[model samples]
Structures are given as C-alpha cells and as structure tokens.
Target: MAYRGRFAPSPSGPLHAGSLVAALASWLDARAHGGAWLVRIEDVDRPRNVPGADEEILRQLAACGLVPDRPPTWQSQREALYQAALDRLVREGKAYPCACSRRDIALALFAQGRERTRHGELVYPGTCRAGLHGQEARAWRLRVPEGVVPWTDRRVGVHLQNVAEEVGDFVLKRADGLFAYQLAVVVDDADQGITHVVRGEDLVDNTPRQILLQRALGVPTPQYLHAPLVLGPNGEKLSKQNGAAAVEVAQPAAALAAAARVLGITVDPRVAVPELLAQAVRAWGARYP
Candidate 1:
C-alpha cells in the first residue's frame, strides 16, 4: 500500500512548540516515504475549541512549508461516518450502552475498596454491561476482549498492552452524545487511508485503545512512530493545558529551525524558511525513511 500519514491536532488552542514537533515529524515522515500527508482538525470537543484556532493552525503550518497534500478533514464534520461505525459495532454486539457516570464509578470503586489504577484512570467496573434496567443510556462503550495488543513503534521499539485488563470497556460516545476521540480517530484514519501515524509519545498509551477499535471495526491498524516530547521548564509535557507558549509565526525560519532541532534535524541559521524546511526534509528522509 502507498504510505499515508497525518497530523491531527485538536483546535482547542494554537499549535504550540510540542504540537509543532509532532506536525513536523508527521510531515517529514510522509515526505521521506514519498507518501501523501494530510491534516485533520480534531474539533469534536466543541466545548473546548478556541474560536479561529483551526484557521490559525493551518496558517502556521503553511508558514513552515508543511502544507497538507489535500484539503483538511474536520472531525466535527465527520460525525455521520463515526455514527455509522458505532452503529455497526452495536449491531455486532461489540459495543453496548453505558449509563455509569464518573461519580457512580468512583462510588463503586470506593465501596469495593479498590484503588485507582497506576495510570490514574478509573477502570469502569462494567456496571451497565449486562443491562441498564430502566435507566437511559448516557453513552456507549466498546467491549474489550482479554488479550494483549502488541505493536512495534518505529521510534520506541516493541510495546504491549492488554486492552481488557488495562483499559476495560472504553466509551465510544460521550454522555453529551459526542463521538469519542478514540472512535472518531479510528474511523477517520481508516477513511483517510492513513498507513502510518507519527505523533508525540504522550499518545503512545492511547495507541492500544485505537488498535482495539480498529480491530473491532475491521479496519487496518496503521504503523506507529512516537516522537520524544517537549517538556516545560518544570519538566512537564508542554501542552495548551499547561499554558505553553504558541509557536511564533513572525519569525517563521527561526521557529521552524527550532522545531527541526527538537527532532534532531539541524539547519543553518542563515537559511530562509523554505530552504530550512528543504534541508530538514532531506535530513528527515535520511534518518527516518
């Protein structure tokens, strides 16, 4: 199959340095394999979206010469497709309605005297799996089977996770009736024919969840590459939630070079944006291709 990769960013905020690194790596990897690179705005979480952030992100990517191979896809506009997949999963008995709220889950765990998992995620105790009785469904969750999902990462080597044991049954749609990121991304990647996924290491844990969804939905799981993270001065992951500064587009060359350096690509400070990106592309092709 021809290689296809993407940079899917949530429009909750502008592209910060950390997100820019993921974008650059995705773009460079696509270029290295002589494949198509696409962009997708993950705006499904409408409540958190910053007005005009999507357009600003595109402008910044353009300024860095990391243009998409085609027009971008927006998750907010792809709800029908996600719903179709969820419906299929429901029909196949792979997913079921969930009525448990966060508080309900906490109380159940507390009553059982069970501590939260090391990952700090509240493992759903399958409260509504058998039946919801007369309660209305607040969300839908996929049933994870007991087995280890194993995949090798291009950057980090082999990895493994038992979806059922670790993730339990995960939600496919939220209580607000919004398609969950796990479901939306799986459907979108398969629809876009994304063959490789190059992203930040922060998402590495989510990979197994996505893989399980892909299998349950009968879609191919893409190859994975997780780039090193950019940390804040306090050694936390640089993210919008942490108030990381947005990448400065005023000095495109400098910003692009800084991002390139983070990915281990060096460009002459004197080089303009275009040339700097070209050099970085060549380096990336040699290193990653």
Candidate 2:
C-alpha cells in the first residue's frame, strides 16, 4: 500500500515548539518513505478555537517549508462524515448514549476511589452502557470489547491495551454536539486514504480505540508511530493553557531550532528556513531509529 501521513493540528493556538516537532516528524516520515504528506485542521471543538488560528497556522507551516500535498481539510466541514460513522456504530449496537455529566462522573469516580487511571482520565463506570435510552444523553460512547487489542508502535515499541480496563467505552460524540477526536480522526483518516499515522507519543494510548472503531466501521487500520514528546523547561507538556507552550513572536528560526533540538537533531542555530528544513528532514530520516 502507498504510504500516506498527515500533520493534524487543532486551531486552538499557534504552533508551539512541541507542535512543530510533531509536524516536522510527520512530514519527514512521509517524505522519507516517498508518501504524500497531507495537512488536516482538527477544528471540531468550536468553543476552544481561537480567532484566526487556522490561517496563522497555515502561514507558519508555509514559513517552515512544509506545504501540504493538497489543500488542508477542516474537520469542522466534515460533520456529515462523522455523523454517518456515529449512526453506523449506533445501528451496530457498538455504541450507546451516555447521560452522565462530567462532574457527576468525576464525583462518582472519587467516591469509588478510582482517582488514578492508566489513561489519566476517568475509566467511565459504564453507567449508561446497558439499556440506556436517549434521555437527552449528553454524549455517545463506543463500547470497548473485553479482550486485549495489541499493536506495535513504530517509535514506542510494543503497546497493548485492555479497553474495558484502560478506557472503558469512549465518547464518540460529545453531549455538546461535537464529534470526539477518536471518531473524527478515524473517519478523516479513512476518508483521506491515510495509511500511516505519525503523531506524538501522548496519543499512543488512543490507537487501540481508533483501531477498534476502524474495524467496526469497515475502514482500514493505519500503521502508527508515536514520537517522543517535547516537554517544556519545567519538564511538563507545553500547552497554551499553561503558558509554557508559547512561541517567541519575534523569531521563528529560534522556534525551529528549538523544535529540531527536541527531535534530537544537531541543527545550525541560524540557518535559513529552507536549508534548516532540508537538514532536519535528511537528518531525521537517516537517523530516526
């Protein structure tokens, strides 16, 4: 099969060092294997989206010389596809309505002393999994099977998850009327004919859920490689919410060098954008092991 990969970014903020690392990694992976590198704007969550973030991200990508092979796809415009996938899951009885509010679920988990979980999120208690009728279900969750789903992550080595224990039935559509990332990503990947998924290691845990959904929805499972994360100076995830993920507005070259360093490349600190990208891609492709 042809190799196809993508750099999917949510337009909640500008591209930070961590995000640039992910984008560069995905771009190198696709180009190294002679594959098509596509870009996808994951703007499904309208509430968190910042104004002008999408166009700004596009400009940043162009500035970095990572123009996509095709016009970028926006998840906001693909509601029909996500809805169809959700309906199929519902019809197959592989998904059900979930009425539990986030607060209620959190309190219940706390009451049960299930505060710590493998996925770091609540391992939903399957509260509405059985015999749940629409009663204004605020969300819909895909039912995870009882057995183990195993896949080898290209960068992270072997990975295994027992869905029922790790992530219980996961949300497909939020009660807030937006499709969850799992559902949207699977549908988009299948629709775009993507064959390889290169992303940050943080999403490694989500691969099983996505694979299960792909099978249930009759889509092909793509190969996955979860690259190492780029932590901030505090050794924590650099996120806009935390203010540690911000990019230096004055110098994108510095940001590119920082990203390259995070990816383990020895890059010249003052190279031009094109030269820097060429060096980074060649170094990454030849040395990524």
Each prediction's whole-model lDDT (CA): 0.91, 0.85
* Superposed model 1: Cα runs more than 4 Å off: none
The C-alpha local distance difference test score for the whole of candidate 2 amounts to: 0.85
Best candidate, lDDT-wise?
A: 1
Residues 1-289 of candidate 1: C-alpha lDDT, one tens digit per residue: 9999999999988999999999999998998898999999999989999999999999999988889999998999999999999999999999999888988888987888865773778888788889899999999999988889999999899999987777789999999988899999999999999999999999999999999899999999999999989999899899999998989988888887888888988987577877787788899988876
CA RMSD, predictions in order: 1.2, 2.2
**In each prediction, how many residue pairs overlap at the backbone (N, C-alpha, C within less than 3 A)?**
0, 1
**What's the true lDDT of residue 51 in model 2?**
91
Q: Kindly report which residue pairs in candidate 1 clash with one another.
A: none
- Angstrom error of the Cα, residue 76, model 2: value is 0.4
